[model samples]
Target: MKSLPRLILDIAEQLPEGEVLRSGRFLHLGSRSAVQRALARLVVEQKLFRVDRGFYVAAVDGRFGRRSPAPTRVVRSLANALGEMIVEHGAHSANKLGLSTQIPVRCIFLSTGRSRELHIGKKVVSIRHAPKWLMALGETGAGDAVRALESLGPLWAADAVPKLHERLPEGEWSALVRARGTYPSWIWNAIQAHMGG
Candidate 1:
C-alpha cells in the first residue's frame, strides 16, 4: 500500500509529459484505499498536481503530457469528459501563447462540430457550427483552437471571402487578411499584402 505512491508516480512519469492523473484510469490498480493513499503522498511531494478532489494531472511545463496523447488526443479527452467538442480557443489560446491576458472566462470554439455554449471548469465555451464547405478552408492540428485561427489564409480568399463579411465585419479582416492570419513566412506574401495587412 505504501509503495503505491511510488508506483503511481512511476506510471505518471511514463505518460507523455503534461498529462495529468485522475481517478478513472488509476482506480483500476488496486484497493481504492491504496490508490488514494498513493495519490495523496505523490501530491504532497509535488510528484502530481491535484486540481481538485480525485482529479490530478502531471505538470505541463515538462516534456510529458499525462500520456503524450497527441494534441488531438488531448482535445478529444477533454471533449469526452465534458461530453462535447471542446474547442481550444479564446482563453485556451491565452494559455497556449503564454500571454498575460485573462482567460476568456469562457471556452468558446468555432467548429463544424456543434453549435452552443459549454460550461467546463467554471468556464463557458461557445461552439459555432460552420458548414463543411466553409470548414474546408482550413485544417487543425496541435493547438487546434489556435490552428483554426491561423488557417484563415488570405489566399483562401475564395473560401474566406464568404466568411470575411461575418468574421471581420470591420476593416480588421482586411488588415488581418493582408497579414495572412499568422501563417508561416514564405507561404505567400501577396495574399496577405493585398488583403491589406
Candidate 2:
C-alpha cells in the first residue's frame, strides 16, 4: 500500500488549486489517523491551507506567491461535497436586482440541505436554511426575482412590478401569476393588480 503522504500528494495533484479536500475522502487510501496526520503535515509545510475543520485546499502559487483560493469557488466546492442545493440569499438577490444599494458584509447563501458556516481565508460564508417556497425558485432568473421580491418584503414588493416585468421572461411571469397563491398574499396582490386580474 502507498504511504499516506504519497497517496495524499497523488490525490492533490489531480485536484484543481481551489478544490477543497476533506479527510473523509482519503479513507480508501489509509486509516483515518494516517490521512489526518498527512494533511496536518501538508498544512505545516505550506502545501495546503485548512479552510475549516478537516477541510483543506491546495495552496496555488501566483504573482505574490502562495495564495488561498477565492471564497466563492471554495463555497461552491463545499456545496458539491455536501450534496446540498444552494442559492443566493434574498439580500444578495435584492442587490443584484437593483433594489438595494448596500452590500452584505458576509456573503450568505440559502441552502435547502444544511445550515452551516464556513471560513475561506478572512471571509465568512453562511449557508442558511431556506423554506420550500423560496428554495423552489432554484437557479432560474425567476428565482432571482422571487428572492429580490422577498427581500423587498410585502411593503415594498409592489415597487418591483416594473422591474419584474422587464427582467422576468414571459413564461416565468405567467408561471408566477398562475401560482400566485403559493406566494404571500401581498406578492400575489401586486402581480394581480399589475396584470389587471
Q: Which candidate is the best by lDDT?
A: 2
Error of model 1, residue 110, in angstroms? 9.0
Can you give the lDDT of residue 164 in candidate 2?
82
Measured against the true structure, the TM-scores of the candidates, in listed sequence, are 0.40, 0.84
Top candidate, metric TM-score: 2
Task: Give the poorly placed runs of model 2, Cα more than 4 Å off.
Answer: 1-3, 6-10, 44-46, 51-54
Clashes of 2: 0
Against the hidden true structure, what lDDT does model 2 obtain?
0.78
Error of 1 at 70 (Å): 13
Query: In model 2, what lDDT does residue 101 have?
Result: 88
What are the per-residue Cα lDDT tens digits for candidate 1 across 1-197? 53667677777777664343566667767788878887778666666665434555554343552222233333444445445544555345434443323555544555656675433222333566754433333333223322333443434434433343354435544444444444455223533443465
TM-score (C-alpha, index-matched) for candidate 2: 0.84
